[model samples]
Target chain A: MMPIAITDPDDPRIEPYRAVRERDLVGRQHRFIVEGEVVLRVLLQQSRFDIESLLLAENRIDSLSNALENLPPNVPVYTANRQVMDAIVGFPIHRGILAMARRAPLPPVEDFLATLPQEALIVGLVGLANHDNVGGIFRNAAAFGAQGILLDQESCDPLYRKAVRVSVGGALIVPFTRVASANAMVRALQGASFEILAFSPAGQEILSQVKPARRTALLLGAEGPGLPPDLLAQTRTVSIPMSGGFDSLNVATTSGIALHHLKSQRS
Target chain B: MMPIAITDPDDPRIEPYRAVRERDLVGRQHRFIVEGEVVLRVLLQQSRFDIESLLLAENRIDSLSNALENLPPNVPVYTANRQVMDAIVGFPIHRGILAMARRAPLPPVEDFLATLPQEALIVGLVGLANHDNVGGIFRNAAAFGAQGILLDQESCDPLYRKAVRVSVGGALIVPFTRVASANAMVRALQGASFEILAFSPAGQEILSQVKPARRTALLLGAEGPGLPPDLLAQTRTVSIPMSGGFDSLNVATTSGIALHHLKSQRS
Candidate 1:
C-alpha cells in the first residue's frame, strides 16, 4: 500500500472515516468504522469486505508497515502528525492504525440457516437496539460455542464502530445475518428444525432443565421491555433461576449464561 | 417535604449538584449524579445514602410531588427550566429529575463478608476500570444470587454516575466494598473459609467441572488483559469452555455466567 501524508482535518478524502461518528444517525448509509491494528489486520485478511482507506500516525507507520507488507501496493494509506490525527478522531488513536471498510452484504434468512453447520447452537437477537449489548452478545456467543448469530430487522447494526469495539472483534468471527422480521426469522429457524427457546426472567422452564438438542436457538431481547408478547408467546420460554431480591441480568450476560448451560448439557 | 423552587443554576444552594460532569476527575471530592424518578425515589427510600440536593424541571415538580411528600422538610429541592437543567448537565436530562448524593463509605473487607447470609456466592473485580462493566457486574451479581461485590483498589468506582446508570440502579441495592490489594482481599476471603476461583481463559479447570461451595468468590479481571499474574496465582484458576477459534467473553458477562452456574450448583 502507498502511504500518503494528510495535514488537514477537513480533507474530503477522509470523508468515509469522518462519517463514522454520525453513522448511527444516517440510517440508509450502511457503512461503519473499524479501528486498531488487530481488528484492521483481521479484516484485511478476511477478503470479504471492501477496504476504504487506512490511517496511521507518521511516527508509528514503520511498525504497522511491517505488518501490512503483504497487502496490495495500491491500497491507500494516510499518515498524519500525532496531533493532527488525534484532532480528526476525537481521541488518542491506539495501535497507531485505523481502517474504514465497507460492510459486507448480509445473507438472506434462508442462506443464514443453510450456511450453519448441522447440529449447531445459535443465539438469536430480536429487537435489541443497544450497540454495546449487541457487541456483548457477540462476545458471549463466541465464548459459549454458539455457531452463529441471527439478527431480526429491528436490531441495531452489529458492524457499528462501537459494537465492533465492544465485541473485541468477535463480530468478525461470529458469522451473523439479518432477517426481515422476528417472526420471519423464527419461522425460518423452525422450518430448519431448530428448537426456538426465548429467554425471559419469568420463564417457567429453568434454562438448566432444558435437554440439549441437535439444533437450538436461544432468543434474546433488549432490557426494560423484553421480548414482544407475540414473540414470547411463539417460542419456548426459559429462565435462569436467580435469588429473590435480584431482578434480572443484562441481556448479553443472560445470553452467555444460558449459552453456557445449553452447550455444557450437550457435552 | 417542602418544595422550594429556585430558577438559577448558579444558586449557592444547588452547589452540590453543579458541574457533575467533572465528578469523575475530582479525586478527593467523590459525588455521583443519579437521574430518573424511580431511581431517585428508590435511593431516597433506602436512606443508606445522603442526598446532597435534588434538581427538577419546573413542569416535572408536580408529577413527583406525591413521591417527595414524605421526605424530611429540610431537604433542598432546586428547580430549573428545561433548558437550564439540560445546560447544567452536559446532556439532555432524562425523567426530569436528578439527585446528587455523597459517596457511601465502603464497608471493611471483614464487615462486607460478615454481612452476607450463609452460603454466599460473591463476585470479585480487579482492575476493572470501565464504569459500565463495573455496573454490569453489579447487575449480574444481583441477578444470579451473588451476595455482594468485592473490588480491588484499582477497580473503578461502582457508585460513579455512569456505573449507577448502567447498572439500572442495582448499585443502590447490591452491597460492595473496596480492598487495598488483591492479595489482601484474597487472604481475607481465605481466612473466612471461602474458595477463591480466579476466572481466566487459560485455566486448567473448566467451569462445569468445578462444583460450587457454600461460600465462593468468583474472581474476575478486566476484559483484554485478564487477571494480573500475581493475582491469578493467588487464586485457583478456572475457565468457562469456549468453542475453537474464539477469544474470550466480556468480563462482566463471564462473571454473570459464572455466578449463574455457581448459584445453580448450590441450590
Candidate 2:
C-alpha cells in the first residue's frame, strides 16, 4: 500500500488542492475538490465521475488503506506530512483526506426527462443559491426516491465542494441539470406531462387533498420571497397547512415534507 | 423616535452588546443576543419577553423609526457609528441590529404540561448537541402548531446566538423545557398521556400510514447515532419510508417530515 511521497509543500503534483477555500471558489478545469472519506468513496464508486488524484495526510494513509484498494494504479495517491499538508492547503487540514474529481455533464434536460419512468417524482429549484440548501435538498430527494432534480441557472452548483460534502455525496449519485430559468424549467416539466406543484404560504389546496400523479414535480423557491406570481398562477398550488400566522418552514425542510407526501415508492 | 447617540465604543450603556461574538458565547446572566432587523422586530413585538435595551448601527437607525415607536420611553436605545459598532461587536456587524432581552425561567415541565389542551402536539429531542438542529426543530414545531418542545440534557441551548438567528426567532416563541436524560424525557411525555413515537430508520411502520393521535409527541435523536436502543424499545417506532440504499436525511429535515405527517391541524 505504498503511496507517492511528497516532501516539499510546493510540489506541482498537488497544485489543484492549494488554498482550497479560495481556489475552490475559482473552480477551474471543470473539476472540484471532494473532502472527507464518505464523499471520496462516493466519487470512487460513481462511474460518471473520474478521480484525478488523491492526497492524504501521512497519518491518515494507514487508516484508509482498505478504502484505497479499489483505486486503479493509474489514479495517483499522494501522501504528505502534517506540515506540508497544512502548507499546501492554506488552513489546518482536519479531515486529512482530499480528492480531485471531475464529472461529465449529465444528460440534457430533455434526454433526462425522456429517461424517467411515467411514475416519477422530481424536485425543481428556483433562485436558490445557498450551497447547504441545494445539498440538503439533493440529499432529501435521494432519500424519498426522487427520480431526478431540476434547477434554474440561478441555483448554486451542486458539485461545489461544500454542497457535495453536505449532501453526504448524494449530489454525486442523484441525477440533476439546470435550465435557463424557473419559468422554462416549469414549462419543460409540464411539456413532459409532469404535474407541477408550486408551494407557497398562500397556496389554496391542502397537501393531503391532492392525489399524487403518475409524473410529478415539486417546485420550491428560496426562503423569504417564494415562487414568482406568474409561476404560482400557472401551476396547481399545494400548501403544507401550518399554524396560522407562523413563518414558512425553511426551504430544505419544506422540500423534505413535500417529498415525503408525494413519494410514489412509499412501502 | 430619537435614539441615544453613542460616540465611543467603550460606553457602558451598550456594554451588553459589546464584543458580541465572544460575549454572546460566555452568555452572562439570563439574557441572549438577537441579530438581524427581522428578528429584532420580533423581539420588540413578543409580549412574552422583556427587552433590556437595543443597540443599532447609525446607518440603520432611520430605517427602523416606525419599529421603535412602540418601545417605551424608558427602554434605552443606543446608536453608534459603523466603525464603532464593528469594533465593539468583534466583527463587521453586517446586519446592523442587535437586542438584549431576558425571560424569566419558564414554568416547570409539569406545570407547563398542565396548561396544555387535551389534543396538544409536542416534539421531543434526545442527545442533540447541534444548536442549529435544536433551533430548526423549534421553527418546524412552531409552524406545525406543536404546543411544546422537550429536550434532554445533552442538547445544545436554543438561545445560543447562532441558534437564535438560525431559528428566525422561533426559538424565542416556542415553549421548551429540558429533562434529565432521554429516559426521563420519554417517561414524562408518556406519563402525561401523550403517545410517544420514536423515529428510527429500522421502524416497521411507514410515516403516512400512522394516524395522528389526539395527544402525540414525535421523538428525534442526533444525526449519526440515533435514539438509544433502550428508548426505542419502550415506545412505538415510526420510519419515514425512504428510497432504499440512500443515507438518512439531515436530522432537522427528518423532523420536518415527521412533524408534517403528525400535524394535528389540517384546516
Candidate 3:
C-alpha cells in the first residue's frame, strides 16, 4: 500500500481523526481510535474490526513499512509531519501513530454465551466505570485464556482509547457483549450452566480455597463500592485475603490475581 | 485548628502547591503531595511522614473538619475558592483536597531490610518509569502484606503525585528505598537471605508451582524490556502461564498476581 502524504491539518480525508480527545467525550459513532505502534499493529494484523485508515507521523512511516506492506490496498495509509499531525489530533502526538477502525456490532449476550465451549472461563464486570480497569481486566482475561466477557450497562467501554492502549490491545482480541444489569449478566451465565463467582471484600470463601466448576464466571465491580450486595448474595462470593486495614487493590489487579488462580486451579 | 482563608492565587504562604503539574517535572525537595479524602485520611492517621500543610477548596474544608481536629497546630491548613485553587494549581483540582508532607530520609537499603520481621515478603521494582504502574504495584504489595519495597535506579519515584494517588495511599503506607541498580537490589535481598524471584516471560519455573521461602522478594521489571538478563540469570526466575501469542500483562498486574500467589503459598 502506497503511503499518502497529508499536508493540511484540516484535510477533509482525515475528518475522523480531528479533535480526537474532544470526540472521545461525545461518541465515536461506531468507530474508535487506536494509538501507538503496538495497537496499530494489532488492528492491521489481528483485529476483527475493519480498519478505516491510518494517520502516521512522518518518522513512523519507515519503521512501520513492513507492517504496512501487508495491509489490503483498499485501506488508505495517510502520513503527516509532526506539526500537522499534532494540530489534527489537538494534542501532541507522542506515539506518532493512530488508526481509526469501525467497531463491529456487539453480539447478543445469549448468543455470545452459547458460542462458548462447554468448559469455559468467562469474566463479568459490573459498574466498573473506569476504562483502565475494564481494559486491564480484558488484558488479564486474554492472558489467562478466558473464553468471553460480559459487561453491565454501567461499565465503561473497553474500546475507549486509553483502555485499549492500557490493555496493550487485549480489548481487540477478547469477544465481549453488554447486558442490562448485573442481575441480567448472572442470569445469562447461570442459564448457560456457568458457575458465577463474584468478588467482594465481605466474600465468604477465600480466593485460594475456592475450587471453580468447569464453566465459571468471575465477576468484579468498582474499587470503592465493590460488587453490590444483591449480586454478592446471589453468587458464590470470594475474596482475596488482604492485610488488616488495606482493602484497596485496583479492581483490575484484583481481576488479574483472581483469574490466574482460577485458571491454574482447573484440573 | 482554624482554617486560614487565602483569596489570591499567588499567596507566598501557599507556594509549595503552586503550578503543581509543572513543579512535578522538577523535584519537590524532600516533600510530596497527597490528594482526595481517602488518601488525606490515611496521611493524617497512619503515615510516618510529617504533615507540612494542606490546601483545600473551600467546599472541602467542612468535610475535612474531623480529620483536621487531630492535626498539629503548627501544620497550616489553607483554603481557597475553586477559581483561585484552579489558578494556583494551573489546573482544575477535581478532588479539591491536597496535602503537602515532609518526606523522611529513605533509610539505607541494608539498614531498612534489617528492620523487617524474620518472615517477610518484599517487592523489588526495576525500570518501571510509569507513575500509575508504580502506584498500582505498591497498592498490590500493601494489599498482600508485603512488608517493604526496593526500587532500582531506573524505576520512577513511588512518591510521584500520580503514583501516590493511584496507590490509594499505599505509597505512604509501604516503606520503600531506592538502590543503585537492579543488581544492587537483588544483592541486598540475597544478602538479607531473601530468595529473590524475578518475573520474566522467559522464566524457568511456573509461578503457581514455585514454593517461596520465609524471606521472599518478588522482583519485577518494566513490561517490554523486563528484567535485565544478568539480573534474571542471578535470581530464581518465574513466569505466569500466558496464552499462546499474548504475553502482555501490565507490569503492575503481574506484580499483584505474583505477590498474591507467593503470599498464599506461604504457611
- Candidate No. with top TM-score: 2
Interface RMSD of each: 1.4, 1.5, 1.1
Evaluate residue A96 in candidate 2 and report its C-alpha lDDT on the 0 to 100 scale.
91
Candidate 2, residues B1-267, lDDT tens digits: the string is 568999888888888877877776677568888889877876776535788888898889888898898787888888888898898888998988998888558666677777888988888889988988988887888788788888888988888888878877778777888788888887777778988888999876777888777888889989889999999999999888777677788888988888887772333
Pairs that collide, model 3? none
**Model 3, range B1-267, lDDT digits (tens) per residue?**
878899998899999999999889997988999999988988988787999999999999888899888799999899999999999999999999999999989888999999999999999999999998999998888788789999988899888899998888889889999898887898888889999988998999999998989899989999889999999888899988888777478898998899888888884
lDDT digits (tens) for residues A158-186 of candidate 2:
98988988888888877888788888887
DockQ of each: 0.70, 0.76, 0.78
Model 1 has fnat of 0.91
Q: What DockQ number belongs to candidate 3?
A: 0.78
Q: Please, what is the TM-score per model?
A: 0.89, 0.95, 0.94
Ranking by DockQ: 3, 2, 1
* Residue B92 lDDT (model 1): 73
Clashes found in each candidate (C-alpha, N, C closer than 3 A) = 0, 0, 0
- Say which candidate scores most in lDDT: 3
Off by over 4 Å in 1: A1-15, A22-24, A27-31, A45-53, A65-78, A83-95, A245-247, B27-31, B45-47, B50-53, B62-78, B84-92
lDDT of each: 0.79, 0.83, 0.89
Q: For candidate 3, what is the DockQ-based docking class?
A: medium
Task: Report the TM-score of the second chain of model 3 against its true counterpart.
Answer: 0.96
Show the colliding residue pairs in model 2: none
